[model samples]
Target: MERKSQIPRKTHILVISQYFYPETFRINDMASEWVKRGYKVTVLTGIPNYPMGKFFEGYGYRSRRKERWNGMEIIRIPLIPRGNSSVGMVANYLSFAVSGFIWKAMTDIRADLVFTFEVSPMTQALIGCWYKKKYHVPHYLYVTDLWPENVESVTGIHSKAVIYPIQKMVDYVYKNCDRIFTCSQSFIEPISQRGISKARIEFWPQYAEDFYRPVKKEDSLEKPKDEVLNLVFAGSVGYAQGLGILVEAAKILKSENRRVCFHIIGDGRYLPKLQESIKANNLEDSFNLIPRKPAEEIPKYLAWADALLITLSKSDVFSITIPAKTQSCMACGKPILVSADGEVQEIIREADAGLCSDAEDVCGFVDNIKSFMELSTDRRNELASNALHYSETHFNKERLLGRLDEIFKIGA
Candidate 1:
């Protein structure tokens, strides 16, 4: 008798994101892993320009629009980058939404499911829901930030007319998606209140890529000598980071002769203003503003630092938003200096990873830095150890990747 043959399941995934590989987004790693799991993954993204306004070298309309990356297909669409001005930022978002709409309407490729790696400008997910409606496929949305709330918090836009339309767009997207995955548990309430059923939304914490783990300090990166403590802040230099408070704290530390040097690694629109502030305050000696480092190279910077600093503007929305760098800091086995509120503070306190201060509180930030400096080497190591342990237990890469299978299976 001949035995019946079994066929492997087809898991064709279409990922909609404005950012992808070569950009330091967790979605890039997630897509690569899905490909390794035998799923055929295709990313629909804009050109590589991110954090920096200009297109990345060798990438433009003249360059290849479609390419293979780590066993997945990458299809680039046309969109204006977030250039220096507020008007330019709005144009960037609109450009992507329009171009993405055209591309989705014209593309013939079908998927068993659609996934959106929603960072900000929730407009990116608009295309995913569009695909779902057109193809009748399950749409899974991983919301890293909440819209309207995020908009108002980040941009200080409070006009009812401006917010009402955006709020409607957000609701429409959430209502259409089959599942909503939030990076923080706190996100569940806002999304639910937007009329999305609680059953449809689930808490899925962000995980650091494997490359983010602790590494031996590289000699190339400068580390302060003698008794000075190196406190590093790595990521965007945007207004929302509330780095002005850091500048204020630097002024105080300088006056008091506190041996703490702030190593700021990243760049953004706010950089020019920050540089001006540094010049005005004569903080050239206290602050080192380094350009953004590649994701793989960041662990070395973390290793060289005595502690890592994460800050945000004082806003209700920011309180619930956990900076993605938080996990990376913990994964690097470094003590954290968090000057934010809500979930971020809770994470630091629970993991015993580091200390926290109120956002934009210059005096509190100064005090915390001094406190970290005063902690014994053994105590600091203990905090670092706890941080690593927390990352292992709560954010193990493989464990988190394993969870994705269920999400993919939802509509398969």
Candidate 2:
């Protein structure tokens, strides 16, 4: 007699993130991927107000509170919209923690483990700590942004009064979580210094989505008519991106009569300032600021470019971060032009994927661009190939996800 195969029990995971689907965060994909892997995933997040600092259309305080997308359940709680102001952002962060506390107390949702995707406003991790304590389950935190440091970097708050409290909160969350994952290995030491053992922390780098590969430019997409080399910078145009230096570089390139153009795609809080700089410098002809496009459309834009650009502000915290865009640009099979420092520069150098410059180094950035402009077609293609190969070997999505699956299973 043939024996019937037993069905494995689905390990339910409660994911805590302030941002989710429709917000274009990697967490959306991770949650969906977990669902695909036969795990029950439920997201506890806030109303979608991100780079734009407002709620997405059709989503609000009372609208679509609970929903399902890509086989994962979503539970949106009440939180102030992150309006375009520092005070509003603080309120938005605090409100989520308060709302999540209330929801956790009232809701009977069951989960075997808690996973928190921490970008900024590390306060979001507090909910995961609470869930783990209440349910006696493991809590894993993926630290994309280092707290207190990120807060000081973004807010320019150097006072110990402000940072001390935030540091205390960071310590509390770090102490409570069972396993901590950092996006960059550089982050490990800082977290370890917080009294958490290095053995409990792992570096799990971000991976590009499957759709980020090289694609043929569609006929409908208009190609540049000029012979100028185009460098495309895609993703958030925020202050942390250190895009202002590009304006300075464009000025030098324009004065030198270089045949090059910068195409920046995406919108963020820093866009207005960047635009003002471009206009003030009269470099409009040298720069193109395109509106934000869907994630799926980025590859096409990248294909139209001669090289891709990625930058970050000059800060100890920023230096350690390998921006998610770095992986996406590499996966697009294009030569990258990096104007940042630390881990990202190392990645580009190790892969031979592109030129690198220290953060805020205007002359170095321009020199790199000029170097790219002088490269032969074959040389450029070689760099692009290296980038694609590096992405496949080191940042493959399936491989990272499988590793994550093992970690989750063991924790469960």
Candidate 3:
């Protein structure tokens, strides 16, 4: 009975995220693990609507405001859905920030620490900052993307007057938060340049979800019996991804009669444009746009690929960011062909996972694809082996969780 006294007190963690379970964000797994470890985990999130804009089926006007998901108490607030336009996206962000503020103000749920899972819209962190101010609890911002820079890059907005308020919002969150956790090491320098102290920010990389692992391809996972070498690009086909480069590469490959096929999965604002480009190029047979599938099904698709492709637009902000899908592809134990610069390239180089070409470099992309195609089976397998090894060594879920646990326990 005396030994029971040695057990640490539970850390009550309140997670604030615009995205959560059933929508595919890392915070879901993190919060689930927190519950398993005997911590009190509560989530305050917006209604289920992301990427696709429309609310998920059975969860619209009459749904309950609060619910339970994976042993945590979830509080969902009403917010505008993110439609596929810059103006609509801004409205969505503002709606969440406003609704989240009202919910937190009225709710009595107390937390030892408030943690935010930041992506796309940086204004969501504003709620966490407000909670910190009101409750005097430690607010930890987990930044997957940086704002103002990301905002300007994604929207192509060059006017300082338009971006100044967003910059102030970013600066406000940065100054008020107790500590910042970032997914990329490269993010540190950029974040510090915004007048934040390096010591307050920690580099915590993204990990593949539990379901993203190597699985044997069975008869049920059969692909069409074509001699075409399959190269797959998975994830949102948005402007940020610069998938037009892949279309250009496909044209070059077809011109030279390279027996390669590019399969693109997932939807975004650019999917229509990508399809149109493929049609106009008369390369529909070479580039296939498969409809988006659920997260669980992605591993099978990865297993079906000869090589996985990842790319980012040629923007300074994106160069510092490593797409979370990079970790997912590596975890699936497949050879990766990267067409991006900076941190992701550095990772691929360090792991010898596959090959890299400059973003938007169509010829460089074509050359890399041809080079990959020419590799012997043994060489390709070796690269695949290296990718699996690197994922296990660096980006496993357990390692990242343990680090986050330590951070949460600080001054507890």
Candidate 4:
């Protein structure tokens, strides 16, 4: 952080995220990409707390901790960690916002613009707005989740009693930011209806540095099979992912005399229930559920599968946003199964990766699976190749984020 500001900075960028590396969220990639391009970047984030809702070992609340990763400076502070539920989650988010503001305000170097991620830090966007006013830090806000709408659909946490204030809070933050980011291709309509102009917003998708490159069939698989098709889902087992539908589709595939296996990997609050559902359905032989693996291990699984599944809930809120897994899956050069509709559907069609089913329609899910399974080897390989090409050109970490560095003037 002591690097000369006279390095002719286009602008100094301060990324305000409740999660970052050592924590592992999309913000880390975004902030780091700018640094790679010679930007002077600093990240203000909370203690490493996620999934477990507790501070990561060796790290605790109070006082600021700083470290350098790949030339970028990451500044982590103590904040109350919240679990993935209403009360605790809100408290966790509030604490980060409160703590980040107190600590960031006292720093010597000022930022030109502040960028805040949408999810978590439920109340932190308001604090970012306050910073914009106090230090004149023009801002960029990324709406990763649609908030009360998404929370209600996933957790049933809000009502008219609770939503109105949240809406106002959303409005306050959006109104103040110079430009807003809506990562999902589907998120534009809802907020645009609320007064955020289309011109002020831009699309930013999750990126993984093409680290998810296509895995060689022989090098990546554990139990290799030359003739059978394998399909996989590699993220959370949570309700928001609509994984129940994946299991249902697996049952259908089994009935059809198809040989494809469904591989689900990742741990979440919903894992136990998912296991129970599998047992109740007697699907032990057809589906395989595995624990989450290290980040470096993902491409191997993608290489092991013929196609990858990506889904969002039937929740009105989730339909508008494409999950990051969709991009990761495509990056691996695997064909895609995008079960959620709208912009997500458009993305798959555009990529020529694979087909989408009607949201929540198990019958359609089964049909799509069968069709993909029935494809000729040449056809399937062609689709997979198209998906990989699309991802590299459109979603790679370096190419997709140049606008971000330009906006912050950090790498300009």
The TM-score values for the models, in the order shown, are 0.96, 0.97, 0.95, 0.90
For all candidates in order, the CA lDDT equals 0.88, 0.90, 0.87, 0.76
The C-alpha local distance difference test score for the whole of candidate 1 amounts to: 0.88
lDDT of 4 by residue, 1-412 (tens): 6875564654567777787877656677667667767667878777877766777677775534787887777888667777656688778877777786787577776877788887744577776787788888688888888866776776676778778887887788878888888888677777777798888877777776546788887788455345667778887667678778877887787777777677887876678888998888888877778777765687886777878998776877777777777778888888888788667788889889998986788998888888887889898988999988888877867656766767665311
Better of 1 and 3 by lDDT: 1
Index of the highest-lDDT prediction? 2
Candidate 1: clashing pairs of residues: none
> lDDT value for candidate 4?
0.76
Cα lDDT for residue 156, candidate 1 = 91
Instruction: Give the poorly placed runs of model 4, Cα more than 4 Å off.
Output: 1-10, 62-64, 120-122, 224-228, 255-257, 410-412
For model 3, the stretches where C-alpha displacement exceeds 4 angstroms are 1-9, 219-225
Pairs clashing within candidate 2:
none
lDDT of 3 at 7: 71
Q: Output the worst ten-in-a-row residue range by lDDT, candidate 1.
A: 218-227
In terms of lDDT, the poorest run of 10 residues in model 2 is 216-225
lDDT by residue (205-254, candidate 3, tens digit) is 99988888886767215373378889989898788998989889888888
RMSD of 3: 2.2
Report the alpha-carbon TM-score of model 4 versus the true structure.
0.90
lDDT of 1 by residue, 190-217 (tens): 9999888899998899999888888777
User: When superposed on Cα atoms, how far off is each prediction in RMSD?
Assistant: 1.8, 1.8, 2.2, 3.6
Winner on TM-score (2 vs 3): 2
Q: Clashing residue pairs in candidate 4, if any?
A: 11-409
Query: In terms of TM-score, how similar is model 1 to the real structure?
Result: 0.96
